[model samples]
Target: MASTEAPEVLRYAAFTGDPAGGNPAGVVLDATGLDASRMLALAAEVGYSETAFITGRDEARRRFSVRYFSPLAEVAFCGHATLATSVALAERIGTGALLFDTPAGEIGVDTVTGPDGKVRATLTSVPTRSRPAEAIEVDATLAALRWAAADLDPDLPPHVSFAGNDHLVLAAASRARLADLAYDFDALTAVMRTHGWTTVHLVWRESEGSYHARDPFPVGGVVEDPATGAAAAAFGGYLRTLGLVTAPRTVAVRQGEDMGRPSDLTVEVDPYETRVRVTGQAVPIP
Candidate 1:
């Protein structure tokens, strides 16, 4: 049985200090009485890319069991929502380290208040893996996106990357190509569903260690994600797996510029570790 009463929902924008500058997410601090159906309904009503629900907590371990729901379905993991939820909890419990047991795996997060009085959260993702995209996968995705092989960057080959969730990595030959995003939503959704991919990580390199990115999230019931932490994490893994960057490298990803809601994400990759670290700032939406 689920509670009939409405649960409190908090809105926050992740990856940016400004409320209107990043991806928004709904957070339910205590979803004790909410069932899956209720959570899904609430998520759909909120209509964000994803919503996070904290179902259980272990005070002594500083751990909590969290679940992520999109407007259409439950996802294995959601990075932006995790960052927003961590900041929300830090506001109440003070900034510190926290562990989240998600459906994907255990994720460790650390929150700190900077001298500027902004709360920044860094999340260490689960073990990541990547492999070259199959020829069939690339052909189908290209058709769905209406992109010709010539439009893709030869430097960065297509690959399927995973941190917590899978993302198909595709690099456009030029920034202009990345900016002009118009695709068959249903067709792309079908392609993603076939590969169990969460999003298509479309990116173009700006400079050394800097890139512009866009994500199409039709499966999540969103046309585009202003900022995508999960995909950013996977992108880091992809870069490392392909030897595109040296070890102990940090990449700066700028997204949502085309949508007019700018977001900045920092991804750190280490030579010895398999997990990727994604750091961003989140602010409450008032």
Candidate 2:
């Protein structure tokens, strides 16, 4: 059978209202006939961190198959791409609830039009989990980042956390530390690949519910991610696991300022559930 070409891709930035401040995503509104190779090629051509392909939908249009691709490979799930895709769908189909069947698991996204008539996307991830980081792994990661163990935030120990994809959570003692992100990309990528980490979540906790964050995604062939939904979800799990925040609390993550693309992520933890809810707005890139 002949393969059909994919639909034209729409580009959008998620988590920030400004076009210059959020993570860029490629949204293929309809990917009925596109294959994995085509999607991956398209993603590489777009050169964004991730691109989302929307496959066929169920009878109610509430359930759909979604695939995510990075510049170099396909990811199990992508938070920023999910948000961008939801906002794009909301602009056309109107906002409500949508379910995505990703490689990792089912994800729920709710879209609501704000007072400004802008659609905001909220994604509820799979059940979250975390484990202590091995001493050797931590040391390797630090060496790749060119930082000493003392530079880490004592309150937030290193750990591997997952929402949809896995990430290593490393908290900085100060915002300055997070801002100065100079690391050996290849070295970091090797370490991340060894541990099956998607990205390194570098964070600085501002308060009980607010944080400043940066994500190094050398493994994805990107130096850094302007907006990271997966890392935010993982961080939420980390916060809950460490008893840093009570359940049913909302945490805000401020990211991308250092890279000139400022983005915001709102994470909500349910009292009785392990899933993390991440909310943000996405806008079309001009």
Candidate 2 lDDT over 1-286, as tens digits, reads: 4256547999999998888789999999788788888888889999999999987787376788999999999999999999999999889888999999999899999999999988999999999998889999999999999988988999899999999899999999988888888999999999999989999999998898899999999888899999999889988888888887665899999999999999999999765678999999999999
- All candidates: TM-score: 0.98, 0.97
Candidate 1 structure, TM-score to reference: 0.98
What lDDT is obtained when candidate 1 is compared to the true structure?
0.94
Clashing pairs in 1: none
Task: Give the candidate number with the greatest lDDT.
Answer: 1
lDDT: worst 10-residue window of model 1: 238-247
Task: Give Cα distance to truth, residue 186, candidate 1, Å.
Answer: 0.7
Error of 2 at 88 (Å): 0.5
Cα shift from native, residue 50, model 1 (Å): 0.2
Which ranges in model 2 have alpha carbons more than 4 Å from their true place? 2-6
lDDT of 2 at 26: 95
lDDT of 1 by residue, 6-36 (tens): 9899999999989989999999999978999
